[model samples]
Target: SGSTQCDKLTSEKTELTVTPKELTLTTENITATAGTTTTLTATFNDDTLNTGKVVFKVNGKTVKDENGKVIYAKVVNGQVSVEYTLPESMKAGNYTITAVYTSPNSEKLTAEATLTVAKASNN
Candidate 1:
């Protein structure tokens, strides 16, 4: 061979780290009747990551929707639970309830449950 050339190179690389998936609500399907109360509970797979300061919303409404209102909600040991009291005056129908959770890392997540309101019985 008249001429030859060779080259060698080496480099260091850094990898980016990503956080694990946050907690989520795993409960759905709720049934109730007019003039009665229903309690729905949702459990999170990763409880340690979720703590105080979780927000709950129904049909994009903070307090009262076009039809109903949220009675109460609380987070206990990484599980977010809510109790909704359907007013006796409310018309029987189907409603969609949602729970929006804000993680400590400022990530927004949502959980949904279906609420079926049965007609009041004539007694």
Candidate 2:
């Protein structure tokens, strides 16, 4: 009598995990003369859970509300950063800068800060 042999097969599956979180923005208080141009910057952190594009705005203007709105807004190493200059002719006052990030899944996050403009000294 001859012996019989048997074999068994098995399959395995793996799933990726991802979490949604808000982006972060940070900057120093802006201080500039009335007639001098000043650069304002905002940094974005993906929080290790969310990754996507971000939008920036100043005083509710649309000029700073898009990816290409500002020349310095470019993504590098999974981070989004933007640098923009304030016009020399802007009036002396306090202004607020706001940034919003929208994830691939339609999740939105916002951050804001204030900028103060000072009058030039005549001395």
Error of 2 at 35 (Å): 3.5
State residue 16's C-alpha deviation in candidate 2, in Å.
7.8
Kindly list the per-residue Cα lDDT of model 2 for residues 1-123, writing each as its tens digit. Answer: 744575565778879798855455664467776655555555555434335565566687633523544433443444556545566676788887766656677766666777777876679
Count: clashes, candidate 1: 0
Q: Give the poorly placed runs of model 1, Cα more than 4 Å off.
A: 1-19, 63-74
Instruction: Report the Cα lDDT for candidate 2.
Output: 0.60
Span of ten consecutive residues with least summed lDDT in model 2:
63-72
Give per-model TM-scores: 0.65, 0.58
Candidate 1 Cα deviation (angstroms), residue 88: 1.7
Q: Which candidate is the best by lDDT?
A: 1
lDDT scores for all predictions? 0.65, 0.60
